[model samples]
Target: MTNPIVNLFAFLSLLLFVHCDGSDPAIPEDHRFYETMMVDGRARTYLLNLPPDYYKTNEDLPLVIGLHGTGGNAGQFERDYGLTEKANSAGFIVVYPEGIRSNGVLGVRTWNAGRCCDFAMKNNIDDVLFIRTLIDKLVSTFRVDAKRVYVTGMSNGGMMAYRLACEMPEKIAAIAAVSSTMVVASPCHPSRPVPVLHMHSVLDAKVPYNGGKGIGGYYFPPVDSVLGAWSAANGCAVRDEIRNDDDRFKLTEWLNCTDDVMIQYYLTRDGGHAWPGGQRSGNWGDTPSTVINATDLLWEFFKQFEAQ
Candidate 1:
């Protein structure tokens, strides 16, 4: 008999997969599926946005893995962040990974970003391993620059980004956490220096810049504590001078790191736990104009590091 799994998966695939039609299509038409695999026995979908010239050339391109926040999916990020558009224009490939969810609940997905995740938090999911497998698949399938692989996430996804940097520092180039802080059982001490950019809103009641009273009713290490741990691991000097932006976001930048790995913090005064400069997704109503696009600012930060 024909495999029922294959048939069901094919139907699901048809519903999820769509071709990119634009002045610059990211993935090649011939390689539309990109690839697929299951994690935790659940159907986790991911979208691979290829650079326009991927099919035309063999030059390796940077790969960016964008993780979505809680109650989010890959498609939402693909449209809201416009990562596909950015990847097509910037000559990089973007991978949008869907988070695994549990029974009966629809659309409420979250990452195993250590502390949060009503389901994943209890299951002890191996998200780091899942990411490693995803990376291995992409590297084998396309001309991905091994040294230029980066991770960025929003909210819970941002926490996952920090986890990756802590556990897989050698594998990633750098990381940017937007409206998310680090969540660790103990503390994350990276073996090697990984550049990090943390952008958060001072007024964020939900994952407050000062820390306690997390969104999911959990406690996490404060922002200052998280930054201090990374600084210690990365061997950054304690900055005496603090810089304040027009938006009331204070930054204490640690300059001149080994191998040019530096740490920059973007603190916005009025913007709440929202992506520093991302579109207000109705969650944080009426964000200010001074709030810069987190994606653009993150791209600027990520460009500073090269695979060493």
Candidate 2:
């Protein structure tokens, strides 16, 4: 089935933009709510952005949890991904979780991601449990629609999203992972398969699209293998002849057992291992040289799914 709204946007210019604070670009919020959460007896910080309409609406709003990559904090997520502006306009509550670092490791913060990140991967820290606990706390305190919770992330964060799908499918409705490959190893499948949207650049030197080991001090699963795993779990059919606008990128949308459960694969021609249109800095290496707006693409994909 064709998406009437997305079809309309296809002809029109896709305008993706961002809003950043002048100073402290890392800390994306000025007056947003935040908290320091203790996970596994460690102090971790997270920023919460309640929509302006949060007070006005009687109905519960959807919640989106964002995870940052290694060597990044929540602030970088806010400014780099342009999620603050996107969340503000969409009227959804956005959560940014900070990764914990071990014993004074300079510029190193990573999620265990099963195969990578020595501290997270080797120590057997249960990040899925932490995220579940965090969601439980948020739902109790705020009027979050439990059925509509979503997750998105970059690199390590992307891997975490895959882990969450495997571990907490009932809790998360959908996920969007950018420039990151799946890294969790689980024989068990999701209790309820969730929708997934994966975007990656074919030219990504860090995480190869064709599926080999990851470069730049990170480990990840093969993209095709991960998709195959999800397909088997969800019982989705593989489609030939991809649907896309141009050769710049090719998109394959898979419909699972139910129409509600969908998965999309976006293969970019020469895009790199970075959030499209994300902010640039000397500290954060491999920022996409091109100016593509991933925030807009994420929202466009996210808007299509509703809570079960």
RMSD of 1: 8.6
In model 2, what lDDT does residue 16 have? 13
Per-model TM against the reference: 0.84, 0.84
Off by over 4 Å in 2: 1-31, 216-219, 238-241, 281-284, 287-292
Model 2, TM vs. native: 0.84
> Local error of candidate 2 at 233, Å?
1.0
Model 1 misplaced stretches (Cα beyond 4 Å): 1-35, 40-42, 238-241, 282-289
Question: What tens-digit string does per-residue lDDT give for candidate 1 at 39-136?
Answer: 65755667787777888987998989998776666766676666777788888888987666544324355678787655566777778878988898
Estimate the lDDT of model 1. Answer: 0.72
- Residues 152-176, candidate 2: write the lDDT tens digits: 9887788889888888888888899
